[model samples]
Target: MTAHAAGRYATALFELAKSSGAADAVEADLSAFRAMLDSSPELAGALASPLHAAEDKVSVLKALAEKAKFNELTLNTFGVAARNGRAGDLGKVASVYAALAAADRGVVTADVQTAAPLTKKQTEALAASLKGAFGREIEVRTDVRPELMGGLIVKVGSRMFDSSLRTKLDGMKTAMKEA
Candidate 1:
């Protein structure tokens, strides 16, 4: 599967970063680069486009990395991704890398969805609350999905804690129908 391949690449990158004492730095760069991919459709298209020559894609990636001032290790890792023609899976690679890094630090990630963006303080508070409940350091990734209408949904590993207004309304409708 693509995820399995991505996990292998991510493990290699994570091991390299760990041995070099730059795992945290590399993880941060991965997040930033993933964000860049999300924000730039043209860049994403170029990387994922089979029409573009691999060399050309590598050149464009190098130029963009230089402009962004990416560290040598981060740049090299991305170069490998492009060279292998796995550029479209870069985000998945980043996610896998983050998981590896967090596991190394004995932390877990929680995907949080809300109707609106949380402030930094709110995020910290949420993490603290989750830590108190789960007894593990929590890395929170928040997505603002307006369709939720209101409230928050937190997913950690196999467990989900959904308090979204949409779910509440749906439950109410089902109960009323049954009644």
Candidate 2:
């Protein structure tokens, strides 16, 4: 599906899940759906294929939902998406719904890329700083990227704070060259 269509589906699903008070459960189901997509290329291909008949797709989705033991709300959402011929956008929808729910709960997710593993205290301090800056609870996800050389990159929503040594050197090099 096109990115635009996927975003629309995600927004709609987010709204519905929020209203039903099943946001967390739906997010879990979506996480499972993403894992399934990753593990089964055939399933992903089928879902994204526009040539498939709606009924056939719906039946396959229902079977998968049952096998995965998804809650009623999640199953119904999938059914609705299938019937509407928007099954291709389910993955993106699931992602967007999770983000929306997190935001609604005053939680900000930070993607932290660091040169090395951070100690527990460092992680706690980072989370606290982020919480103070964003005025909300912060959930930090850390990834070790040796390319960073030293320091970390923090991303929350559309804003990013890049303090990695590699980035700093690159900026300085660019400035020197320009001068």
Candidate 3:
């Protein structure tokens, strides 16, 4: 259940879901699955533990998926992961799959961590800026981080632009120490 293995599984699942015309549904299912893992510590531990038998894991997943009404492709992917003894990385796989699906649709997700709440106009402006920079439709998720002191930190994909006062001060302090 290494990150690489999870990424491979995710890529495969994304391709399959795309071809089957259920990419959006599969992504939603995976998002729900990830949320379940986050909210249920016991279930998360069980899924990530290698001590459970494959059959037991599959049964648990089956029950959970049925209750959640996950798409067939998503359920099948989970079963395949269990059978292959890679169930431990299912969460990561789902994450990668969702990101891939978003990218396929020319959508980019921006994580905006700000010192305070942003107005609707601000959010729209930020999204527009990101769209201009990335040349794609941007989905901006806003989060308040009071520790930021002021300004915003915009993260797109693997890149982060930190304009927060806290980060700027930290950088200056580190530079002085190094000097």
Candidate 4:
């Protein structure tokens, strides 16, 4: 249900951005917003907290958007989301918007999670490999997950490839118990 709402918000935003020739800018703004959410638990909590009124959320988001100098379309979309009480799902909406933007350019999005941050060359190599394997342009979204300990996880559409060390250790533990 939350996914559905996020999709609706993202679709509407994408259409508006597309019509205004600002899809890329909006996507960038949303991506920056998502990064902020990731970095600031207080901000994320404030947006997600039901204790706050919708109008208040709108005001806060609007202030942040203005300070960030986001595109007008992006700011308006955030205001709409906050007004609709979907501020908590803004991160998901941003992700969906990015996918929409990538699809518009005939590209596929690959969500990559690693135990540590990948270097620019490593990211490029991974993108090249994914493109070769999928026979399509690949847009890589990388996230760091130290709990993985090692290796990486990649998700492209409904398909997921998990090679993380944590999963491997768990698999081995299960096998040993069975044996």
Every model's TM-score: 0.83, 0.66, 0.74, 0.95
Top TM-score prediction, candidate number: 4
Per-residue alpha-carbon lDDT of model 2 for 95-166, expressed as tens digits?
A: 676677777877888879999999999999999999889888998867789999998999899999999999
Q: Over 4 Å off in model 1, which ranges?
A: 166-179
- Estimate, for each residue in 105-151, the C-alpha lDDT of model 4 and write its tens digit: 99999999999999999999999999999999999999999999999
What total of clashing residue pairs does each candidate reach? Answer: 0, 1, 0, 0
Which ten-residue region of model 2 has the weakest summed lDDT?
1-10
Candidate that beats the other on lDDT, 1 or 2, i.e. the better one: 1
For lDDT, the strongest prediction is 4
What lDDT score belongs to each candidate, Candidate 1 first? 0.88, 0.85, 0.88, 0.95
Looking at candidate 4, the ten consecutive residues that score lowest on lDDT are 76-85
Candidate 3, clashing residue pairs? none
User: Which should have the higher TM-score, number 3 or number 4?
Assistant: 4
How high is the lDDT of residue 80 in model 3?
A: 90
CA displacement after TM-score superposition, residue 101 of candidate 4 (Å): 0.1
Q: Which is better, 2 or 4, measured by lDDT?
A: 4
Ranking by TM-score, best first?
A: 4, 1, 3, 2
Ranking by lDDT: 4, 3, 1, 2
